[model samples]
Each structure stands twice: as C-alpha cells, then as structure tokens.
Target: MREVFQQELREVQDRLVEIAELVAISIDKATRAFNESDVSLAEEVIAEDPRIDQATVALDELAITILARQQPVARDLRIVVSALRISASLERMGDLSTHISQLARYRFPDKVVPKSLRSTFAEMGALDVEIANKLTSLLRSEDVQLAEEIRNEDDKVDALHLSVFDKVLGEKWKGEAVDTVDATLASRYHERFADHAVAIAKMVQYLATGDWDQSAA
Candidate 1:
C-alpha cells in the first residue's frame, strides 16, 4: 500500500509537469500572437485553452483521490495539498494566456498597442514567456534556485506592468481610449500570468525545502 501511494505521488508530479509544459506553450504562442497581431495564432491559443482546463480538472480529481485513499500525512500530505493549489494556479495561468490572445484577436490587423508603447508590451510578453518556461523546469526538477529566479523575473514583470500604467496616465499620452484600455488590460494579463508562475514556484520550493520562508524568496 505504501509503495502504491508513492507511485500515486509520482503520478501527481508528472501530471503537474505535463500541465506546466502546456502552459509554457500557451504563453509562448499567446505572446507571439499579441506581439505580431497574428489572428490565426491567437485563435489557436483560444481554442487550445480548453485542453489546459481539462488537464487541471483531471489533476485535481487525481489529487482528491489520493488524499481520500492514502490519507497522506506529514510530507506526503503537503505534497498532495500543494499539488491541488499548484494545479489551480496553472489553470489560471492558462486563462491569462487566453486573455492575452483574445486581445490580439479583438484588434486584428492592427497591433494591440500603439507604436509608442509597442516595445514595452513586447518586453513584458517576452518576460512572461521566459517565466513560464522557467516554471516548467522548476516543477519538473524541484530546483529551488529556479524558484528564486522566477521571483526575480516576476519583479521585472511587475515593474513593466507599472510602467505601462504610468505611460498611459502620463500627460504625454496620445493614444485613444481603445488603445488605453487595451494596453492596460494586456499589461494586467501579462503581469498576472507571471504572478501565477511565481506562486507555483514558491509551492515547488516549499515542497523541496519544507520551509515556506526560504521559499518565499
């Protein structure tokens, strides 16, 4: 029974890595679509988002089953509980990517942001993609160092997010109402995407080190 329980735990980890990989791909494609105004790619992301949702649902069910059957305690209990929270965060990340792609689709033919803020949005998108990739690695390897790196990248995304607001609200701003709205919404989605990645990284770090404060970095 103990061996079977351990196998279930490994399956939970594998499922998480699989979902993380899907999230990475989603963000990569979503960011590309947002940057280049590729409506087809945007639509592709929107369509595939259901798959990510289904995966998370399945993972949650699995975690619940393990909890009920094995009645895990101590570290085993933490692993199961963390898996549930991590899967929820991953699901939200996928939704944020879809939101980014939706913005691209909404403004098809024209870029989402005006020329003035294009570079800023582009940088935020790139950082989000990088963070998603790093999050996948962190989950698969349980490397606490990767968690710290994710936190640093998330800080960059947060800074970029604030800068977007500052530019839109500045007196020099010239964009129309639609542009302002899109820029704000897009920046928010990008920032929140990184936030979810950081949350997952912290959970992974906690699993590895068993110290929430140490993982809080």
Candidate 2:
C-alpha cells in the first residue's frame, strides 16, 4: 500500500510537469500571435486552454483521492498540499496566456501592441516564455536554485509591465483609447502569467526545504 501511494505521488508530479509544458507552448504561441497579429495562432491558444484546465482538474482529484485513501502525513502531506496549490497556479497561468491571445484575436489584423511599445512587449513575451520553461525544469528537477531563477525572471517581467504603464501615461503618448486599453490588458496578462510561475516555484521550494516562508523572494 505504501509503495502504491508513492507511485501516486510520483504521478501527480508528472502531471504537473505536463501542464507546465503545455502552458509554455501556449504562452509562446500566444506571444507570437500578439506580436504578429496572427489570429489563427491566437485562436489555437484559446482553443487549447481547455486541455490545461482538464489536466488541472484531474490532478486535483487525484491528489484529493490520495489524501482520503492514504491520509498522507508530514512530508507526504506537504507534497499533496503543495501539489494542489501548484496545480491551481498553473491553471491560472494558462488562463492568463489565453487572455493574451484573446486580446490579439480582438484586434485582428492590427497588432495589439503599437509600434512604440513593440520592443517592450516582445521582451516581455520572451521573458514570459523563459520563465515558463524554467518552471518545467523546476518541476522535473525540484531544484531550489531553478526556483530562484524563475523568481528573478518574474522580476524582469514586472519591470517591463511598469515600463508599459510609464509609456502609456507619458506626455508623448499618442495611441488611441483602444490601443492603450489593449496594451494595458495584454501587458497585465503577461505579468500575471509570470507571477503565477513564481508562485509555483515558491511552492516547490517550500516542498523541498519544508520551510514555508510566505515572504519568499
């Protein structure tokens, strides 16, 4: 029975990694769609979000089953609890990516980001992808170092988000209301996606160290 329970734990970890990979792909494609105004790619990202949602739901059910059947204690309990939290975070991250793609689709042939902020959006997208890829690695390896690196990448995303606001509000800003709204919304989605990644990484770090620091960097 103990061995079987251990196997279940491993399975949960594997599922989390799978979700991470899918989210990475979603963000990558969504970013491209936003940058290039590729409605097809945007639609693809939107359509695939249901898969990520299903995976999270399934993983949560499995974790609850283990908790009821095995009544995991100590580190085992921590693992199950953390799995639930991380799964939730990953699901939100997927939704954020979908939101970004939706913005692209809304604007259609015209780019969501204006020419003035194209470079900033591009950098944000690239960093979002980088942080997502790091999350996959962190899930697979459970390396605390990788978790910290993910947080650092998130900081960069946050900085870029602030920059977007600065440009939009600057006196030199000449974008239409719709353009400003789209830029604000899209930048927020990207920033939130990175924030979710950081949240997941912190949970992983907690699982490894057994040190639950709510103030984790």
Candidate 3:
C-alpha cells in the first residue's frame, strides 16, 4: 500500500509539472503576440485556456482517487491537498496570461500605439516568461530557497512597470493620452503575472515543509 501510494504521488506530481509547463507556454505565446503585434497568437493563448481548465479537473480527480483508494494519511494527505491548491493557482496564472492577449488585440490594430513603447512592453513580456519558466523549475525541485529567489526576482517586473508608467503617463505624452490606457493595462498584467509566480512558489514551499505561509515573500 505504501509503495502504491508513493507511485500515485509521483504520477500526480509529474502531471502537475506538465500542466505548469503548458501554462508557461500560454504566457509566453500571449506575450509574444503583444510584442509581435500578432492577433492570431493572442487568440491562440485565449483558446488554450480550456487545456488549463481540463488539467485542473484532471488533477482534482487524481487527488480524489488517491484519497479514496489508498487512503492517504498525514503527510500524504497534506501533499495531495496541496496539489489541488497548486493546480488552481496554476490555472489562474493561465487566465492572467490570456488577459494579456486580449489587451493586445484591443490596442494594436489602430496604429495609435506608439513605436517607442514596444521595447518596454517587450521587457515586461520577457520578465513574465522568466517568471513562468522559474515556476516550472520549482514544480520539480520544490525547494524553499529557490522559491525565495523567484519571489525576490519580482522586483524587476515591478521596476519595469514603473519605468513604463513614468514615461507614458506624462504631460510630455502631449495629448496622446489613449496610450495611458494601454500602459496601465500592460502594467497590471505584468504585476499580476509576477504575483501568480510567487503564489506558485509559496504552494511549492507548503508541499515541501507542510508549512504554508500566506505572507510568504
């Protein structure tokens, strides 16, 4: 029974990692759509949400199966529970990425968008990709220290957001104020993207130590 339970745990975890990887790709594709001014890619990210949703459901089923069949006890119970919570967080991250894609479709077609801000948006997108990739690594390693590193790394995205805001939301924008809306939404997307990354890290930490901290990082 012990060995069987352990095998189930490994299978669930591996599937969790796979789910994380696909969501990361969704984020990257959505960001790329923004940078490249490609509406098709943006639509692709939005369409991918069903996959994330399906994965979340599948994970829940796996956890329930373990709970019913093997009767997980103590630590095993906690890990299985954490797996459900982590999958939900991962699904939210996927939704946030889709939000970015939707914004790109809203703004880019009219050519009112400034050419100068492209690099800043690209930087934001790149940071989001990094966050997603790091979370994927954390999915496998589940190391507390590495999770801290990802939490700390969020500052970069925040700084990039500030820089974009200072430049675009100004008198020097010279009545080109519609861009403000674009910048504001972009800032929010990146900020929330980093927040979800940190959330995943926290979930991993909980799985490892059986100690979950809401205030973590």
TM-score of model 3 vs. true structure? 0.88
Q: After superposition, how far is residue 4 of candidate 3 from its true place, in Å?
A: 1.4
Candidate 2 per-residue C-alpha lDDT over 1-217 given as tens digits, one digit per residue, 9 for 90 to 100: 8999999999999999999999999999999999999999999999999999999999999999999999989999989988998889889999999999999999997888789999999999999999999999999999999998988888999999999999999998999999899999999999999988988888899988877879633
- Cα deviation of 29 in candidate 3 (Å)? 0.9
Residues 100-213, candidate 1: write the lDDT tens digits: 999999999999999989899889989999999999899889988999999999999999999999999999999999999999999999999998898889888888987785
Error of 1 at 173 (Å): 1.3
Off by over 4 Å in 1: 214-217
lDDT of 3 by residue, 103-157 (tens): 8787666532477777877887888888888888888888678788787778888
Q: Lowest-scoring 10 consecutive residues by lDDT in candidate 1?
A: 208-217
C-alpha lDDT of residue 120 in model 2: 99
Error of 2 at 53 (Å): 0.6
Which pairs of residues clash in candidate 1, taking residues 3 or more apart in a chain or in different chains?
none
TM-score of each: 0.97, 0.97, 0.88
Error of 1 at 114 (Å): 0.5
Worst 10 residues of 3 by lDDT: 107-116
